[model samples]
Target: MSTVHKAATVSTGEDRKPDVILDYNKTKGGVDCLDQMVAAYTCKRKSNRWPMVVFSNMLDVSALNAFVLWSGINPAWNAGKTFRRRIFLEELGKALVSPLIQRRKSVPRGAASLRMLNQIRGQPSSESIPSTSTATPPTKRKRCHVCTSNRKKTSTVCPKCREYICKEHSVTITTCHKCM
Candidate 1:
């Protein structure tokens, strides 16, 4: 991408080329032209001692570009009462705005494709999912021999102690948390 600004100097009767020319190599999926334009504006403003910042936020760059281009094609589009002269633009203006609007509206769909690819890997069957909703209540168990004083219900079977304990006391018999 390249930009050339030519000014006809009335004082010298000569055509003056731009003091700054920006040239960028074409890249795949890189920042768009509007971002570049914003950068250019920022760079130009920075050198002029313009105390105020030119552009700071990641604005709707494409909209700004379209607006600027529209204003260029017809000064009446400028921000002010002058715009009242014409509410809209001619065919030439539409031609210029269409591409910009399309570019702004366009979004990369490759991410969706990537997601689709990931989903294609595999999906588990319904049978793999245990049906806790209709699952039968767990059967009650006996108390742990180590803590014979407590008679509590649990899930684990402790062959070493030959006793069962509720989930809380199951640990005394060296049983699992599910047993306690």
Candidate 2:
């Protein structure tokens, strides 16, 4: 159905409502434009569940809004590409879940999926996994590596030094994402 209506403007010899509705109502016109843009490229599916429908709509709208913001912020990005927004959304989707996929511990059972996971892992063998196996000191007990021989027999081996260090000697070191 058309939004236009035959108004009394014909008697006044003017066109059917100038077509400048934004000049009258600003925000509602933006809402309509946004709705139209979201409909063009949406993740929405035919579902009876209202929540899923709402969620998909939210995703589509937010994605469009984010694309607009990103384009405005970085106009030089993909400067002359015809499908810049679509490409941006595709890359954004990949980036959103890439960390989760990269950190996946279990490899897929299927050959293709396993290969894909391996490619993401960038390592052929999991050989560097530190062996948590503790060696029983032959005598009675082994002393702690730190704390002046305090009786804390933490048998965790230091991965780097290959030494049986106690909790006191162990340090949990972390690095930033960019450095990694």
**Top candidate by TM-score:** 2
Q: How does each model score on TM-score?
A: 0.16, 0.47
Best by lDDT: 2
Q: Model-by-model lDDT, in order?
A: 0.45, 0.64
Lowest summed-lDDT stretch of 10 residues in model 2? 171-180
TM-score of 1: 0.16
How far residue 112's Cα lies from its native spot in candidate 1, in Å, is: 32
Question: Residues 104-170, candidate 1, lDDT per residue (tens digit)?
Answer: 6565433224344445756433323334465444366655434556555565554322234455554
Give the count of colliding residue pairs in each prediction.
6, 0
Model 2, residue 59: distance off in Å is 0.5
Assess candidate 2 and give its lDDT.
Answer: 0.64
Task: For residue 180, give model 1's deviation from the true position in Å.
Answer: 56
- Displacement of residue 19 (Cα, Å) in model 1 is 15
The local distance difference test score of model 1 is 0.45
